[model samples]
Target: MPYAPKHPCTYPGCATLVDAGNGRCERHRIQERRELDRQRGSPAARGYGSRWRKARREFLRQSPLCAQCYVLGILRAATVVDHVIPHKGDSKLFWNQSNWQSLCKRCHDKKTVQDGRWK
Candidate 1:
């Protein structure tokens, strides 16, 4: 018997019906997979930018103790300023000091990954 499917493609406006097991029609599924690949392959998604590097050094010199680490009982010494909300599309977010926080490399990376800070 031919297999029926479930969970049609989640692409923005795609209307092609999906399969019972995979959740998407063949074409829509391929498109979705490609999009996922692109997202994963993006430069920004890989890590910080040149601007972030510059800002990080200056921030670290100004404040060396990781704030969140202290709060979390980690006591990590080295720290970097991380934007609470990324400044990617909104350059105005770059200079908003209030939106910045000091965090250890480990905590910063974990927070960004767990909560998708740069993503």
Candidate 2:
């Protein structure tokens, strides 16, 4: 099979040619990922440390079915513990068990988009 033509790296002034599948060159790709990670901070820094993990495990064990799926007459196994309300750096809200819901990945992703958190 013939390969797709190579294209210039889409990182500003760099003219390095890369495969069509990659928008940026390898170097630029690494740089972009590092920048994103720096801006995003570590999971612990965002308050999902050991305490959150233990609480999440217990919550999932007690509520094994997706809340949204249950509402829709489905019985999907839940994998994510989502905040009913966005914490947005509020420690009190972040640790509120009453504001938590068990959700499957699909339902959780949909809810995240609806909550304007994925954009």
Candidate 3:
């Protein structure tokens, strides 16, 4: 029998379908894509500042599968480093690797809109 993606992620309150890429359903997948586009199109992104550019590249290089995707069994390409906690109050927390997670475009959007954590 062919493999089947598990329906309903194992995690509590997770809405992603395990089989879907990035672990999210179609809606979440679309959201992730849009978030990636916004990031790439951002003015700061275009500046090619050494810090920004290097961090972006390093983040991607360090992770392959989206962290959320992995949790739900979807292994899509990851493009963002998600912060576990918002960095607004603690700028020093921004650079902590333990605080970062890889996420596909879809999961990234879900996080952003749901909590505005990345904004």
Candidate 4:
């Protein structure tokens, strides 16, 4: 175990070295996790429990391509099951399959910013 690989933090412009398997350095990891928590709240609180997970799996199986990427002429696989319209705790809206869209991480992040979801 004498030779370990090193890489830059996933955070933008961060020079901290982290293990290859890790996404970010300790400090930036904490900061990013805190920000993500504040934005998304708890998964349970956001109605994303076991039931949601099951639905998500089924949805992804049905729509395996990123909708946004497809619209942009790219054929990326979908990794996130996103609500086309934010549910915002509305049960009816939350359960609507028609409102669901498959998105890759990149498209999902862009959509989150555009939807003002991270503010």
Candidate 5:
């Protein structure tokens, strides 16, 4: 099967050709991730510690399909457990199982963008 064609990195002034689906070259990707991490703080600081990991795993096991996609009549496998309402550092809200929903990466990203959580 033919692979997707390479394209220039999306980083401004970067002429590096990267595989399709990647917006930035490897170096820029690392730089961008580091910058994001610096701005967002560590996962543990953001309430995503071992406990969150365990809960996420159990939730995903119980709800394997993306809730948003399922509502749209699709059966996409979920890889993310999203909080229906932004917790905004509220531990009670963060831990509320009723506020959680399974979502695939694409749906999660779209929701994040819509929620103004992604920069």
Candidate 6:
């Protein structure tokens, strides 16, 4: 069988050649798919629409202290609102304010990665 014509991989700084119709090389294509799947399973995919945004803003307005930082004797301001237990696309769990906590960016990122929710 004839090999498909090749073109440069469209991924940034990549020097690999990919099939003409493909935007990324084989390795990069697989990486991209994994990244996309991560996003698809993220909270953003669970309808974190304007209502959620507004709720976050309001939650922060009411309490701007980082919950984790507070426990650690650090008085860091909260920059992100986090879900204590993952909602996992469940509307009831997602909207439960009792399950929410405020966190700083660093703390939120750490928790996200530790909980396998990082994209």
Task: State which candidate has the highest lDDT.
Answer: 5
Q: What is the lDDT of residue 32 in candidate 2?
A: 88
TM-score of 1: 0.50
Clashing pairs in 4: none
lDDT of the candidates, in the order given? 0.72, 0.95, 0.72, 0.91, 0.96, 0.88
Q: Write one digit per residue (lDDT tens) for candidate 3, span 1-119.
A: 77766687544576666673345656755777788878668645444367756886888897877988898987799987777786653557866778888888899899888885443
lDDT of 1 by residue, 8-109 (tens): 466667776666555556787677667887876764554457777787788788877898878777677766687888776566787777888888788888
Model 3: residues with Cα > 4 Å off, grouped in runs: 1-49, 117-119
- Sorting all predicted structures by TM-score, with the top scorer first, yields 2, 5, 4, 6, 3, 1
Model 5 scores what on Cα lDDT?
Answer: 0.96
Best by TM-score: 2
Q: lDDT of model 5 at residue 49? A: 97
Q: Where is model 5 poorest over a 10-residue stretch in terms of lDDT?
A: 110-119
lDDT of 2 at 36: 83
Model 4 misplacement above 4 A: 1-41
* Model 1 segments more than 4 A misplaced: 1-52, 117-119
- Per-prediction TM-score, please? 0.50, 0.72, 0.54, 0.67, 0.71, 0.66
Q: Write the per-residue lDDT of candidate 4 for residues 1-119, one digit (tens) a residue.
A: 68678989988999889998888899987898798889878887789999999999999999999998898899999999999999889999999999999999999999999999754
lDDT of 2 by residue, 57-104 (tens): 999999999999999999999999999999998999999999999999
Residue 113's lDDT within candidate 4 is 95
State, as a TM-score between 0 and 1, how close model 2 is to the true structure: 0.72
Residue lDDT tens for model 6, 1-119? 88777889999999898777778888887898788888687556676778889999999989899999999999999989898998877889889999999999999999999999643
Candidate 1's displacement at residue 91, Å, is: 0.5
